[model samples]
Structure formats: C-alpha cells, structure tokens
Target chain A: EPEVTQTPSHQVTQMGQEVILRCVPISNHLYFYWYRQILGQKVEFLVSFYNNEISEKSEIFDDQFSVERPDGSNFTLKIRSTKLEDSAMYFCASSPPTDTDTQYFGPGTRLTVL
Target chain B: AQKVTQAQTEISVVEKEDVTLDCVYETRDTTYYLFWYKQPPSGELVFLIRRNSFDEQNEISGRYSWNFQKSTSSFNFTITASQVVDSAVYFCALMDYGQNFVFGPGTRLSVLP
Candidate 1:
C-alpha cells in the first residue's frame, strides 16, 4: 500500500540551530498535517496544510514554526531556533478526503534538541 | 476545544482472550469524526476505523469490533480471541473538516502468550 514517508528518521540539533523535517505524503492526497508527541505524551496537532496554505494551527505552532509545500511531493516543517522542549517525535499525515476522515501517518521523525 | 481521553493506561490479557479499549471524546461540534488507530513497535500509526458523530453503528471486522456511542461521547474497541501478535498501543482520535485533531493518551495492551 502507498503510505506517507518522512526523511531524516532522527535528527540532533543545537538549542539555537534550525531544523527542517521533511515528508512526502501519499500521492493524490489533498490534505496534509504535522503533529508532535512529546516523550510519553499525547500526540498534539501542530498544523494542517491544504492547497499550499495553512488551514489551521495550534498555539503551540507559534512564530518559530513554519510549514511549506515547496514542491508537489514534499511537505516540510521548519523550526527556527530549536528549544529543548522541541525534542519529540514529529509525524506527517495525509488523507484523501475529509468525508472518510481517515488520515494515514508516516514513520515519525524523532527530533532531539540539546 | 476538543479532547480525547483513554482512561486505561495498560491492560494485560492472555492470548486467545478478549479485550476492550475505551475512548471518550469531548467536542462541541455536532458533526465530527472519531477514529481508532494502532501503533505497534514499528512506531507507525495504523488506521483502524472511522465513525462520524451522526452514526451510532456498532461495527465488527473479523476479531476487531468498534462501538461508537454519541450519547455518551464514547468510541470503544474490542479484540476477540486476541493473539500475542496483537500486543501494541492503541490510540483513539477525533477530527473535523478544519484539519485540527485531538488524540487520546493511548492504551497499551499486552497479550501474554
């Protein structure tokens, strides 16, 4: 089955450095999302992207966070000046239609900030 | 704001036994969607079922069953004659058209062989 895929399975960055987490959503899907899960915590929604624009975002997705669909296949989440709390597993998900309400998720990228 | 709660942190059941994972959601929207997902050791979330707020149907697929109750705001899942391979962490999710989603803390189930 076709599924969402993410690059840089694991990343380590300095506290003040920048990091970009990339995802290639399932082709033909219209909606894409980025979610994060702190170690042993619930998965938290960060932002959703559709039609090259952000649909909705949580307060946790503050000024430091940005998402881009620079190409037809790539969806990226960039964190400027990573904080220690940014250490978590970031997941990329996509859904074909909102009617079915099924979003397929990718193998998450583990981001570690030191 | 919407929230999903999975009260049971961990459940232990023997292989060939039946188990249930409970999920309760809080949403103000009359129209929303509830979902069940499984995350095993592979660390990938697997989609299981999706139930809208309007549909209260109880569905069954092989050894897996889901009960969606809008009245109580609960969507529960049951596994029958579970095998050792069924051990994993199960998560329940809720979402709407806007793309924001809420996920429960998850239930860790262990099927002892």
Candidate 2:
C-alpha cells in the first residue's frame, strides 16, 4: 500500500539554527498536515495544507513555523529558529479528497535541537 | 472544538490476555471521524482503524475489535488474545469537517510473554 514518506528520519540541529523537515505525501492525496509529539507527550497538530495553502494552524504553530508544497509530492515544514523545547518527533500526514478520509501518517522525523 | 481523551495512561497484560483501551471524545458536529493508531517502540504511527460518525456498527478484524457508541460519545478498542507484538502505545484521535486532528495522550500497553 502507498504510504506517506518523510526524509531525514532523524535531524539534529543547534538552537537558533534553521531546520526543514520534508515529506512526500501519497501521490493522489489532496490534504497534508504536520504534527509534533514531545517525548512521552500527546501528538499536537501544527498545521494543515491544502491547495498549496495553509488551511488551519494551531496556537503552537507560531511565527517560527511555515509549511510549503513546493512541488506536487513534496511538502515541507521549516522552522526558522529551533529551540531546545523543539526536540520531538515530527509527523507528516496526508489524506484523500474525501470528506471523511482517514489521514495516513509517515514514520516521522525525530528532530533534536541542542 | 474537537477533543479526544484516553483515560488509561498505561496498561500491562500477559500474553493471550484481552485488554481494552478507552476513548471518549467531545465534538459538537454530527459528522466526524474517529481513529486509532499504534506506536510501537520503533516510534512509528501505524494506522489501525477509522470509524465515521454515521457508522456506529462495532467492527472486528482478527483479534482487534472496535466499539463505537455515538450516544455516549465513546470509541473503545479491545484486543483479544493479544501477543507480545501487540505491545505499543495506542492513540485515539478525533477529526471533524476541519483539517487538523485532535489526538489523545495515548495508552501504553506492555504485553509480556
């Protein structure tokens, strides 16, 4: 079965540095999302992208975060400046065009900011 | 607002034991979707099941069964004769017509052999 795939399975960056997490969603999916889970914490929604634009974002998705669908399959999340608290597992998910389609998740990229 | 709650933080069981994980959700929209995902020690989100608001029928797939109760706003998952491979953190999520998903804290299950 086709699945969402993310690049750089693990990333390590210094605080104040920039980081970009990339994802290649399923080819036919129309909606994409980014989520983060702090170690031992619940998964938190960051932002959702549809039609190459942000559809909705949570409070945690502040000024430092931005998402882009630069190409047909590539969706990326960029953090301008990383913080120590940013160390977590970032997941990329995508869903079909259906209203009630289930979002398929990627293996996740573990971001470690020191 | 959409919210999902998984009350059990951790649950442990020996092999072959049946365990149930609880999920309660709060969503005003009559149309919504509920899902269950498994995260093993490998730290990957594995899709397990998904149920829409209109379909309340309980479903069973092999050793896994889901109970959807729209009246009580609950979707519970039960694992029958679970094995060591079933050990994982289970997450219950809720999503409405909106884009984002609201995930529960998750329940970690350690199935010992």
Candidate achieving the largest TM-score: 1
For residues A1-114, what per-residue lDDT tens digits would candidate 1 score against the true structure?
Answer: 998999899999999999999999989998998999898877788998888999889879999999999999999999999999999999999988654367889999999999
Worst 10 residues of 2 chain A by lDDT: A95-104
For each candidate in turn, the TM-score is 0.93, 0.90
Off by over 4 Å in 1: A97-100, B96-100
State the local distance difference test value for candidate 1: 0.90
Interface RMSD of 1: 1.9
- Kindly list the per-residue Cα lDDT of model 2 for residues B3-112, writing each as its tens digit: 89899999999999999999999988888889898999999887788888999999999999999998899999999999999999999998787645799999999999
Q: Among all windows of ten consecutive residues in candidate 1 chain A, which has the lowest summed lDDT?
A: A95-104
The B-chain TM-score of model 2 reads 0.97
Q: Per-residue lDDT tens digits of candidate 2, residues A9-83?
A: 999999999999999999999999898999989888899888989988988999999999988889999999999
Candidate 2 clashing pairs, residues 3+ apart or interchain: none
Can you tell me the CAPRI class of model 2?
medium
- Candidate 2 chain B, run of 10 with poorest lDDT: B93-102
